[model samples]
Target: MTSMNHNQRRGRVVIGVDTHKHIHVAVALDDFGGVLGKEKFTADTAGYGQLIDWSMTHGHLLTFAIEGTGSYGAGLTAAVRRRDIGVVEVMRTDRRDRRLRGKSDFLDAENAARAVLAGHADAVPKTADGLVEMIRTIKVAKDVAVKARTSAMISLKAVLVNAPAPLREQLQPLSKMALIHRCAGLRPGSMTTVEAATKHTLRSIARRWEQLNDEITAHEKMLAELTTTLAPQLCAAFGVGADTAAEMLIVAGDNPERVRSEPAWARLCGVAPIPASSGMTTRHRLNRGGHRQANAALYRTVIVRMQHHEPTKSYVARRTAEGKTKAEIIRCLKRLLAREIWSLMRPLRINPQTVESAA
Candidate 1:
């Protein structure tokens, strides 16, 4: 009687969530992988609270294993962490499992719980509630603006290539900046002729390019200020520009301590070497996983250093003299750069517990 009651009271529970735009499906599982219950919640403040209260009814809320913590699950993750419960990011169910059993939101939610119970889902989702998140948002805007500006420039050039003979010959002689300025100043009053229509199109594209360029500049300025404030040592490193620094910071997230070590940081950037050796031929290959954007940033930094930074230039020369291919040398440089950036940023890691308690 009393013993049975105490055993019931000691039950441990895990909750898994499959989140969507408007709703989230959740499943509660006991420690031994028994299905406790399932529930659906609205993807809002009220719904998140209800889900938490419901899970507590099953037993002690050990953890929430959630998919899409960086996307749809972001809100619930923040809310859960605010209550000091652990959140483990679980990847979507394996395709083979789905093929075997078919699929539903409930199944996914169940798989998430199972992943946590089986010791497979161990990743701590990014906090996404601090300075790094601000940098990430600004970086996204800057990337879009730069991409739009480039597209506008391409369209303007394509128009030039197909413009009337006289117009093409006239603009072909001008430098890119001069051509854009001249086109932006053109006035195609009524657009009654092909040439006039072409003029209007060129003016429209040029103006769009100008506007996007200005927007990009503003975004870059903000990124520079924000990234510098977040990691001064990273920004001060040679060949580490505002854009590259922001990408690195975005990869590290608001909680750098979650990264574990310098090598883990390298692995996260996709610059780490993966073993691909045989018994008699030991070797490694480029890692194709992790954050490619951060990898690209690493490449960009290495390129700049190769050309301008004296020590890096010397290293390149020495490696080349030792018969390393450019690709191999570049990979080596990226790994080293990842290590350097990781150390510079490590000291800046925020203690999320302190932050949550303070809040």
Candidate 2:
């Protein structure tokens, strides 16, 4: 990979980055879309620094436009933010079809840079390796534990379905303890040929599941510690539980400043609908934009809150009486919830003198 240095102090240049797991391709363009340099670099610290040195040596690097900020772009974004470099996230290939033709590492990088110059693709990027990553790791581990517990219960019930009536009755109330003890004592050689084989496999699974639960509890403790040290604003909000708050913070990329407005946040979560107006019918349909996983987090949240939150529940009931379907009502709730979250969260942004204030 050739390292570039911007020896010429040209006007603002646009950088397009095509990212992969270990390598990233970047292309630089002068103010007029003239290709200045293109090269491959390792995604690590040394590589990005060389890219930076190249940019500065040639001229001022205006910004980086990259496709898909949530995945391969994540490492790159984290890398850039650590350097305080300006990077913009471009919508994926679906944003335009023409650019999709003749795609390659070099071409994709060029398109990313061109998109910056053309002003067609861009977003204020959030950090990749900040509190967001910490939150996500904790949440995933907890989810694994919860799933394991659920699976254990399900498997126990399945075993009961075929169990002898007297045995089932004896184990009914003592199910948890009985299952745990039996599973703990089970080994490959403990039973007859067939019985031992089945018991050994199932018991191994149970033991592994129990171990996973222990890991989950440890993660929970870590999560509790981080809740106070970081993401305090999210933790302080009503209806935002630990896992939910952690997910939302990660989705927002830890820096609420780039989230901008309620609509922006909603759109980022794929909850806000795109505007579609026909001659006679003008209504907003759901938008599948931005992060679907984050949108699902909000969806799960509102459902839990709708059962207990009087104001939000009443709002849904009122809208329901107006003949809105359950799905429609849920959609409306998602948007409103996005707005509320944005309002509660905007004050927590790390930036100062921010523009484009939204209600």
Candidate 3:
């Protein structure tokens, strides 16, 4: 009996972690669904070590089911991954369950462990330590800069609208680029009059727009180079440019295998049709879930294809002739694009094992 009990103690264990900004709560459970221990640790390198040591005391560590692997739990996830342990990203527990069972950090952690044991949460989080991550970071800056540049342009135009008659007439006659150039060259000597104040505002805004434009151009060039290097085939594919390709890559993360299949890819991009069938009314509607940015990317690609690509044009024509509405046709085309993208990207996936070893 003692030997059997000892063997039971040696069985594999699962650790669930509810992560936060300053601390992480963990629960250890044996393979047989028995809770072995609960602990809390600081959200840092030293704390991660302590958590791992405490979990190991229960039994052999099998996997960690963690909440917010992309956010709060990211550090701990990376640490566990560095040791080559499996990690599963646990989604938020069902609100209904939480309402019934009540809520606490410890309970949340336990639920995460049980979720893995029950085979509910199986998502592999993105390994945000690669070229894709670099692309994402740069793209973030580029997108914000683009928005700021647009705002500056708008503000420049708005100021011109209310400027003194001579100034308004002078600037309004120019094209957008010409107006920007003229405004940027304006020399406001003093704030003595309305004209000078108007000139000052226009010049400042135009210069800001120019700076942001330069920054955006630089970011786009870097993105083009990195995305092309990472997935030459994807970049070379129809209807995909640097921005769109970056969006798709960000959606897939550095680990493309996490997507599993083409259908999964479509679902991730929110292009997969969702069934809204009821009894005799069998039909699928456009899915409204998944990554919105990816969905927009797919939409942009399809629009480009609809206008330019010969094969896609022909397909659209055929579908249109068959009584399919433009929306339905576009939906189908997005799914097809997702499939093609998945195939093009699969071969380019960097091996996680190779990445781990290099780390």
Best by TM-score: 1
lDDT of each: 0.89, 0.72, 0.89
lDDT of 3 by residue, 14-87 (tens): 99999999999999998888998898999999999899878766766578999999899999999999878899
Candidate 3 backbone collisions, by pair: none
The deviation in Å at residue 123 for candidate 3 is 0.7
Instruction: Give candidate 3 misplaced runs (Cα > 4 Å).
Output: 1-10, 350-359
For candidate 1, lDDT tens digit of each residue in 1-359?
67446546756688999999999999999889999899999999999899888877777646899999999989999998887888999998989999998899999999999999999989888988788888899889989888888899889999999999998899989988898899999998886899999999999999998898889889999989978777888999999999999999889888878888777888999988999999899999999998989999999999999999999999999999999999999999999999889878866764432223323
Compute each candidate's TM-score over C-alphas.
0.94, 0.80, 0.92
Residue-level lDDT of model 2, residues 236-346, one tens digit each, is 766777666666777776566776677778888888889788999997777876787678878888897789888888988898889999888888888877777776666
Worst lDDT run of 10 residues, candidate 3, spans: 350-359
